[model samples]
Target: MPAITVDDVLVLPRLPRLDPAATAYRPVRRLITAPSGYEGEGFPVRRAFAGVPMPELDPFIHLDQMGEVDYAPGEPKGTSWHPHRGFETVTYIIDGIFDHQDSNGGGGTITNGDTQWMTAGSGLLHIEAPPEHLVMSGGLFHGLQLWVNLPRVAKMSAPRYQDIRGKESALLTTPDGGALLRIIAGEIAGHRGPGSTHTPITITHVTVQPGAEVDLPWRADFNALVYVLGGKGTVGTERRPVHTGQLAVHGPGDALRFAADERQDSHTPQLDLYIMGGRPIREPLAHYGPFVMNTRDELIKAFEDYEAGRLGTVPAARVPHSHGQQPPR
Candidate 1:
């Protein structure tokens, strides 16, 4: 038999409900966004990737919000000329469009409800800009970009891309009304996601209606987090109130249980969230600006290579600002 890839052994852990009080819940850290303070015509809006300061959330580095922009006609705001290493970026767009170009010779536009997965292996360069149509219309542009660290063995692997369409991804509807689970890279309720991944991880976009409760089983060996995009709910028995832009980290356990309030009927409070967790690398992380490497020597070499003009692969120039101008919150 041929050697097995990490994907071969990856199986979605069984979903089980844990007692929040009994299991011991860890405090979820809140990451505050700071201005990118970039000084270039192409810098677009103040951008910040959430991974740097929140390094305690190991294995996962950053989570960035692009926008909820309302653009005017013929206006474009976005970013240009960035490099990355030793990590993977997963961009999920809820509204508007994004033109993406990269040093791996990959370039394209991802519209509303699209997901783009880019792995910056040994090294990669890319740019993301918004489109003119949405900008001119002043439409709502909202999206998220998450960074997953690469294990040392795969740090120098070749870069790759997987563009997953909204329709192609798997969706699971709970028996209870108004609850939906969108599985992007992992499994939920026995159904698996469609995208390919380099690591053993689970990514799900979950929505819970008022009075509905859902329980998910996960791995005890992996680090887990729940990011509340909107609405409110309690994880396990903690009954903690979660709001938009807040992240909650759960303790290592076999499952996660979420319960919605049962009393409110007129307004079914919605819970829009992403449940993500993965095996921790536990290795030294050396990150500077946009690049992440396993050692100081490797990081220094990356800079030398880029300055020497040896990292020359470039994606085709794309339409500027197809996605929007707002940076990651």
Candidate 2:
């Protein structure tokens, strides 16, 4: 999970040390473990937001943690061309390579710590797969793909894309330097990430050293969630035990808190977390498959559009995809 690292976290901006007495830390409202599944041409994925309520996940709809698996030669898999409407897909590569291209002309190869931000406003067709060389000589592949819902007004807006590199992320540290924070999007205590989002949100990846704790000030208006990528830890003010593939939903508060256990398996020496929060859109949501709209009719229209070739068609010049797969009917 070497998406980004610092030789000395002390050199980064330190999070404001809040007075514990005054800080209203969020309480863990729910904790759920992600179930493993296969996605897109047989690549493994963990559904990170499984069992979470949609209202609580407003502004953000879905999440998938892609393989932390080592692929043998010719074993890398990827999604075939597909269509999505009324949302954006944020693909962050933590330790592998992924190539993406959409009909709206947004995409490229993103490697360790790189992020592919694709807005499917209105609608578009896209494909994601490993590069040809990677497919030939497979190696480690791990990453996350988060679905961010667009507001009704922006749902039909023009599509766009942003290729964000890992080095472009804003780095911060806990007051005690026990943790490293990589802010991928949104504002955190006057610091902002590079991702230009239609909705206000914050996405961060935190690495906590063993026996260390962290307190992150959060927007009171935003809903919070913490997901463990690897290792063991306790979350929230209640110190609820959490482990790999677990997600913790937090109640309203002005800050977030979690800690790493003193001992962890050698395979995972540090506690890794992907934390995200966003101002709730709180709109009527109608979602089915790749479409996220505000009404059932709209979702039906999205499917109709795709079938009618309104969403988009696969580019003739696109590089080869996994096994020459086609869009699912």
Candidate 3:
């Protein structure tokens, strides 16, 4: 990995740039806004992709909602115990408090500016909820849930967890005074994040100021995408506008240049974007609901083992709804 320095920050390369124009920005194919009891009124959760619907985005599957909510104090609504196999789930919290407990006897709380990484290698059971005080006091709650697929060789590896505090992650402030880049997995500018991952991937959270521009390098062989969390900005040479809750899919390109229009006063002279890419796995992906495996027979066996009580070994905790939830057809 080559490191680039800008203003005392170090950024490293995980992959070369692929063509960004190969694929245009596609609107979120599917969206799910599920209400969470923990967050006040309407807590919209949008499901970008999941399971068999979109097998793998080069080792990635789902990019759920970019949530922004206000939780009334003391509310207890949060995600309950669930099972996952052969993949990883990443929770990035932008604001508020997120507390979690897993069957591995691991439990902890993550406040604003924190990230939780969980690898459900073979299988694991877990539950996530907001903190009681924040939920009742009415505070902003925002975050994202991303699902990354594991290679067949690593699918059955032991489950694990990584909790990264926001202030501890790598940060790179662009020279043009327009972008604040957070290196979550790979490297950006001249900064590298602290989280260890299983694939060759780069995940960045970027904020571009109005009329500011920054060039991002990526590998040509890796697949990539840019997700707009808030505001509007232009990617590459496309002079189009992108708003919140929308994702822009870029083909293989060497470098990504982002620019926000300088004339719009109503538009917050800033753009929030999540830039992610990874080496695509050229393997067959067989998926059903929450479990992603290599074959349908494996999926069937997974179900049988769960029913027979053998698949619950990793997370020792049993979810009440596990038996009743059927595999997706």
Candidate 4:
């Protein structure tokens, strides 16, 4: 069979009309400042909620802020072959390009604003690396990869992949056109995201124009948090100010209000925020590097499966595709 391209798996969610009567929800949870770490051969990464064992943050296991770093020519870095099981990987590229290939005959290039959702159900071996051109002439690399866990019943399901084009995302502008919200996995302003998820989750990328404010609503059952990608801003009813590289873990509330620093600064552009949450699975978690299962026995079985080559293999038809081909806007 020919390799399955991203276009084949891309699915758009039906956009919904906004409910004008929707009540406002403010963030009230504890704040968590993600710590910096390294992954994929010294590539810098910020470990968010998953690094810490917070039962409040379930289903959503780990979130990594990948390189916002500028690299010189020949300094490009990335992850080689690795294995994963029992979770879904959501990779969102903000600046540069990422080339990925997996054991299930899934491979593709994701550039600025694109997202790749890979479900490592049962097991899978994958490689996430930079394209050769980028390695030859480096530039700024910025993106985020989040790991979403599967329920016990779905843990051993067949692996699947979906590459969502940025343009397919539902974009909504504030009434005054001062801010924009990019919905990737949930409804915002009644516009739905592009992802088909086993777990109920919401991932929204917000751009707050200088001196402008925006409000977003999330389900009361979903545990929510906001991660600052750039500039500084106040989040929640308390207006707790959070800056770049900081994560604001919201308390129970139905809606979140984000206001960029009111004092406009041409040098600062605007505030970049990523708000994500989902209904907690509330199950026992046995996690090891690259594996997350309900029990240690299950995790052991996963490793055994991968070792025995139970996970399917990438088809021999792995032809390389050019990168930087942004989806049609």
Clashes of 3: 28
Q: Write the per-residue lDDT of candidate 2 for residues 161-259, one digit (tens) a residue.
A: 999999999999988999999999998888899999998999999999999999999999999999999999999888999999999999999999999
Worst 10 residues of 3 by lDDT: 320-329
Q: Rank the candidates by lDDT, best first.
A: 2, 4, 1, 3
Query: How well is each residue in 122-145 modelled by candidate 4, as lDDT tens digits?
Result: 888877888889988999889999
Alpha carbon lDDT of each predicted model: 0.66, 0.92, 0.65, 0.77
Q: How far is 97's C-alpha from truth in model 2 (Å)? A: 0.4
- Rank order (by TM-score, best first): 2, 4, 1, 3
TM-scores, each model vs. reference: 0.79, 0.98, 0.79, 0.87
Which lDDT tens digits does candidate 1 get at residues 1-329?
00011222114233334555556444333433334343222322323334434445678887765544455665546675667778888988776777777888865778766788988887777777666565566555567788889889998889888888876667665544345666788665567787787777888887676767776666676677787655666665456666555566776566666765554333225666777878777888988867788889998998888777655655455545433332221
- TM-score (C-alpha) between model 2 and the true structure: 0.98
Per-residue lDDT of 4 in model 3: 19
- What's the TM for model 4? 0.87
Preferred candidate (TM-score higher): 2 or 3: 2
Between 1 and 3, whose TM-score is larger? Answer: 1
List the lowest-lDDT window of 10 residues for candidate 4. Answer: 1-10
Winner of 1 and 4 under TM-score: 4
Model 3 earns a TM-score of 0.79
